[model samples]
Target: MSSAVVGLLIQELPKGGMMMTRTLILGIAATIVAAPSGAFADTPAGNQQAQNTSDAREIVCRRMPPPAGTRIGPRNICRTQAEWDLLQQQNREEVERQQDASHYSRGN
Candidate 1:
């Protein structure tokens, strides 16, 4: 029954559509095949602290708005969680430094 429906759908699609459908199916199959190995990876009960540290080093991603300019899409930035924290701190310090420089220049 399901095979008949799939056959009908495939017959209706254009030539490129079959390739796209196959690619999608293969991607899903790969994900399902790979998921369980990660779930069952050897993690020692006593290594909770190590796990937490690794979590902090895990890759995090953000989509930042394009810089003030002509037409362009948002940029994707990826960094470790710790790196992101350091970046935020550095930016904050830079802003403060600029503010102090401006204040001093104003003779206040």
Candidate 2:
């Protein structure tokens, strides 16, 4: 190939990388959406270290699981285990994963 073509290829490097990243991301997303989050679905520990995470997942039994992906402001409220139980067994109880910055976004 000519030098010009080689330079063009180098210029396109990031673009190709972005495309591959996007594809990998989309594939993982699809897998997450299609498969059950059974790995995270273990029963809530009565007093485990991950109480918060357990509280969130336990809501599945009485309340509802958090929504898929990130839930922003004005989301649902799930208080009791009974309510969690009423939640769909699938993934209805997935609370939005809050970053440090977004902690208060849930109308806490």
The lDDT for every candidate, in the order shown, is: 0.80, 0.55
Scored by lDDT, model 1 comes in at: 0.80
Clashing pairs in 1: none
Best by TM-score: 1
The list of candidate 2 runs beyond 4 A from truth reads: 1-16, 37-108
| Candidate 2, lDDT over the whole model | 0.55
Clashes of 1: 0
lDDT of 1 by residue, 1-108 (tens): 244555666577778678898666556666777888898887787797788789889999999998788589898999999899899999999999998888765454
Candidate 1, residue 62: CA error in Å? 0.2
lDDT of 2 by residue, 22-94 (tens): 5565566667666776677775565565676556656432234565686744445645664555554434435
Q: Which candidate is the best by lDDT?
A: 1
Candidate 1 residue spans exceeding 4 A from truth = 1-52, 106-108
- TM-scores for candidates 1 onward, in order: 0.48, 0.21
The TM-score obtained by model 2 is: 0.21
